[model samples]
Target: MPPPLTTTTTTFLLLITASLLLTITTSQDSDPDSDCTNKWIHIRQLPPQFNLDLLTNCSEYPLYDNFCPYTSNHGLGQKTHNNSHSWYRTDPFMLELIFHRRILEYPCLTSDPNLAKAIYLPYYSGIDSIKYLFGPEYNFSSQHGLDLFHYLSKTDTPSIWKRNFGHDHFLVMARPAWDFSQPISNDPPLFGTSFLELPQFFNVTALTLESRAYPWQEQAIPYPTSFHPPNLAYLESWINRVRRSRRNTLMLFVGGGGISANPNIRRSIRLECENSTSLSTHETGYGKLCEFVDCSNGICEHDPIKFMKPMLQASFCLQPPGDTPTRRSTFDGFLSGCIPVFFEEMSGKRQYNWHLPEAEYGEFSVFIPKEDVVFKGVRIVDVLMSIPRVEVRRMREKVLEMMPRVMYRKHGSSLGLRSKKDAFDIAIEETLQKIKSRVEEFAAQ
Candidate 1:
């Protein structure tokens, strides 16, 4: 205070202050709460044909009623309310649009490719395929598919492609992997185009709702459900409600009869439920505390609260393969905190590794093999009743804890809303880790 400071000293002090401020800012940015906030993701801005054009004419799709309006609100579709709380009810097949919208608004998204951890190609492959698959011109699906490949092969910057042959790039599709990766043998004609078989997708990763055994590059993500809670408060409230609610039914099966190719496990379970008798004094018969909703007959409800009410009231929800091994209802059951009972191994265990805990099978769910249920004379009621009450409670708790991870929140909303990671957050984190590991392996090679 006695003497005037020199210019060099003042400059040094300012630099020190700046360094400290930067350190604080960086620490805040790197906090676990801010995990996805600072992540570096590069989205490939394609021509309008790939994404925007498809959305512009969304009504042309066969399921336009379900597709058009829902594409708005960031692919969250229409906002719905339950118990006086607001939430978005989304379409399972609208994930392509939802993911694209989210990535564009993601804080991690960077226009500069040099600072990116991984590249994303935001093509609405799912809806695009739908446009051609259900259109007047069916074979034109192949042409639509070709245009995407051609653009990637010829027009998109060669530098990115040449760098790693697309191993670091990824695409998200709402449809099953098999839809796009149809077997070359046209003995049984497939519905969608074979865009996945193109050379452009060789090393590229595909995030789809259902992944086939072939093409090791596929990653299965959860299908979008009706409930998309905006913040931790809403999610917590829902979890608490499910936790406090009384489960009057022991087990429930809410699907239609299966196709001829695949024996209908739901039908067998329904028969068991229909035959079970309530326990009075000494013995228990089948179907004591069981309920069934035959979706085939339009008896099943689609309203979020009405649908989840039954699932939440049941101890376990029977999840059989619906047309495919995976069903969006599996996630719906999970969202309602209903422990799932799987007949097929691939239905849950083999899928959702990124989002689910890597615990043992019986830890969170029950697996009665389809063979046991069909031919081995194993009764579904008997199998469920065998589990101890304590074990059932443990499984339900595990399911409740997993609710946040399975949900997809609104895109570009406050990061504060993500104190608990949602499905999108987990996907982005896991994708980055996978890309890093793969890049390291490539470098080693």
Candidate 2:
């Protein structure tokens, strides 16, 4: 027995509450821990961008995510991309987001009728998948997530894939049959067919990164379950905001993760150096096997974190793509306040994954192809001679200008999402929906 206006207000309030519940319920349909809040996820894969301190010295920083120690479980591209190799094999974890959720490991694939039907998971992340080594019927699609291979060339044929290749949206991972002599194109010897093609194909095509398009934009996806790691370091204030003081400095990149061990993989660096510039004594002697170099100034090692700390003190960092093009060292250099000197391979070889920030390699980073490098024209040494030391320093400053957006990591603004970064949140959410929709469509068959 309320007043008429009061009754109307109550009805309106109730309606709004009901509507909110419905919305949340829909969102929770895919995310069971939607309402639960906690410190952070443990057993999380740390992004390459994370410094070694945050990764290795978990005991030093109590404020960071202590629940999850950076273990081999989070090793990048190890288990998924190189399962056949005994040395590279690692424990499997769900690549997708897990919010205090139990991870189901598909270590061995046995065709059990009761086994939940295989879910098609597309890996758009630059890191290759180890699934190929297992030789399981995989569901693959250029339509789901980011497909770097298909993005390079339109009219890329999906038909060459084997029928049991699990064409729907998944395919088994196997070594590529093609040679590295050929670059990415719509032509035959599709790299996606097997793992062997992985080494031969570098991710350096620069098609999608230059085009500013995500691989999954054309497809429909489901709402991604928030990618919370089971354990992560406690959120620190330092991580909340990127350090702004450091700008354009010398960055000597060192990469030795799972990808560096492959003999077939080697980055061709293009630096702006004088033709007469010497290969830091180390390169001349060790060449590809070069580990660390003690120069007149300091030590140069193949450790990204070590390279970052000192390199950030200088105006430019020498960023060479790792053995394969999908190497993210260049991006990592940019995050450390060091401008990348991009060395594109004239061999038409592409290295590193797509989704790289677009900027003039010369302005912020220096891009030198392998042929030019050999010719000593735009070689790292040549550029160093052409520009004054002061000018080179200024170019490094330009890289610092764009640092905030370049580095990918969990920020203070993160809403419980880990493993999946905030920068990619919207894209990942859409990707999940597309994957779900595609999966449903395939199941209908």
Candidate 3:
């Protein structure tokens, strides 16, 4: 049986009291004669910003669907809910910039000359021509793709049909590389190893399997919404984290971040529920869901935020990054007061990944290494299973405390991309930096 919802308010109140108690108890225990400057600072003087109003929403994006009570369910290979357009067109400039940068960073162009020359063939095509090469498979409806094609094609045209198309210049050398069907085959031939082999050719390669973390995202984009309007109101059922725990119902968050697709991390999460019967999947894969949340025909009213709140109500939120550590699961889980158990160093070494949002993890997020979960010496499931009920409750409280600021509408907060630059500036900086550094290195030689 699930924990009673009646205990929610009490749990919330107790959490507030605990924070006060912790501060008071710590001060009383401190050495009065000690030089305070070198000691830990008291909580009161630390920062006024920590005082939290737990009633606010945690999602940066507001709901764009006109309908409510969206419950959608479809079997494998079918979307599990009503496909909302809101997640289709959120940030245009950022997407375009990322794509542009990616094209410029093509691996073949940077590392192999002949292969790079062969691949750069598409970019030289007429604007209309290149647009068609992208094909319909790309998320063209998204704000990013929308802006990209607008710049590539004139006056809203969507095809590359009118443009001159040829593969002969570079293709003759690249055709062997296209045989990706046989991974065991030898590496394709190249004219030279020089970084500038095809110096002028630019095209983004297909995202590797590892890069495509959010494979299920048919249309995972955000749409524009008025900054945090005053009308937002939703009931938050505060509950003791321990008392709220449920069995078998595995909470899952499939987002872009720390746990997305590292083989080790992915392997660990599977280990946790290796024996359990409860089943849950977060919006886009990671988050908490309310008892009422479900989908019908690829459509559901599962706003990532609202969905997370209820997910906390469950036993677990299975969180894996959509692509890397910068995935939105951190923001979603932290905002909804759900405990996010993670795999270690999700963003540490992978090149070209973004950073996780700034938030205290010890109190809300859980990090474990693959070694701890895999094999007989250590099991992630065993460690997770052993965590006491009371401890989990405390973690949940920490999550709830930060909910308001995590909401997408909250301007300038860590989770929000308030201005146009907030969304795309970092990507732009990285892109230009790489281009400049690469060009200079080649020139120097």
Candidate 4:
């Protein structure tokens, strides 16, 4: 150990320490907003081929009857009604564009990666993957990874990608994580590119609407709902309407997939709806005990009223597993203030850890194993109706309480009251925290 310092030396060291602490405090408190809003984002300006070019080649986009009308308003489709400007028939794939626009308007964007807590990789992975789905070739396989590697490996500037080996970067996947996962063997002619599988992206995190569970590399965000109220006032009004609305129906399911040849729980749900629903119930002022709006044509269409009506009037919404484990309808149920009854753990527990309180999930949502519903003949209506009335009300309130953060705000409209932090806001905050945790862990390794 060194000898004790003199008074002058000790005083000089104390002053230096105070200055360092002050510098750190100033930097950390730079956002002036809450600690949650302290994320300084650095958005990658990738070559146009990654985002803009893919969008410009709209001729290749064959989804939704070509030139999807829903692409208007930066991915929120046209207004659902002549009167409602806030609500839209938003296309499912519009989250990336919505997020990009939000980033452009973000308060604390940094030009230098050194000042960024997280780097947003604005590659339209969802848009790029769609082109591969209709392809007769696998050429788009590693092109993205190759170009991405070249871009991040540049020697002209300090490489942020090299700082944490991609842990500091993240991608927003509007589609499910599986859509970007390419199988090892193309012998089956896979429907996705190896964009997420490439070595360069192995450590990168993703914000996806649906995630591949087990070894999760992505975070699940809420699937966009049709209603993005113009302001907080509209949102408050809608909440009041949902709370005061008479719930005459016991349970509701609005999805088509019931008549598939493969194993399905919707078929059982359909049979129960057909056999158990009686006209007498409506006469008794209980309305339909159960309701189903068939949408087996491969879409939970963007029509808000058509979907929200039954959910609004029902105590529970049946969100059975679909082609994948997760469903967009679940988010719709949350927005409608209807308690969603999930059939798979992958559907909820493993997906929205960042958005929903995993320990308190039972307070807002219900989960019945798919095995019981599909194989053991557990009737969902019976399971749901068994929930006490007080409990049902409490669950509905919990859902509404957790609602605003799961949705994107109206595009380019700051005209109304908004949630303190909507889905876009939550995603950014969580992404920054996750990156910080990951980078620190990586450094220790």
RMSD per model, one decimal: 11.5, 17.6, 20.7, 12.4
Q: Give the per-residue Cα lDDT of candidate 4 at 321.
A: 82
lDDT tens string, model 3, 220-287?
Answer: 12111111211122112222342354433335544322333554555444444443324344322223
Candidate 3 has its poorest 10 consecutive residues by lDDT at 68-77
Per-residue CA lDDT of model 2 for 342-401, tens digit only, reads 555411123212123333444665665545654544445345445566675576566555
Higher-lDDT candidate of 2 and 4: 4
Ranking by TM-score: 4, 1, 2, 3
Off by over 4 Å in 1: 1-38, 62-66, 81-85, 140-144, 185-188, 258-263, 277-288, 297-302, 412-414
TM-score of each: 0.84, 0.40, 0.35, 0.86
Ranking of predictions according to lDDT: 4, 1, 3, 2
lDDT of each: 0.71, 0.31, 0.31, 0.74
lDDT of 4 by residue, 1-445 (tens): 3334434334333543453344444555565365525477777767756765555544444442453465566666678888995688877777876676666656566666777778888777777776666543355564545666677767324477777778888988888877777854555556667666676677888888788765446888888877777677778888888899888888888887778666678888888788767535743345677888877674557777778888888888888887788888888898888899888888888888878868988999999987897789887767876778889889999999988877777744464554357887788778888888988888899
Whole-model lDDT for model 4 versus the true structure?
Answer: 0.74
lDDT of 1 by residue, 1-445 (tens): 2234334334423543454344334533543445444367777767756765566555545643535556656567667653534456677778877776555545555555666678888787887887656776465444545676667667877677667777788889888887777544454445866667666576778899988765467888888887766666777777889899788788887777743455567667867777764444134322237887666743332356556778878889999886689877788898877889999878877878898755655777889988888787899877888888889899999888787788887664555666778888788888888887777777788
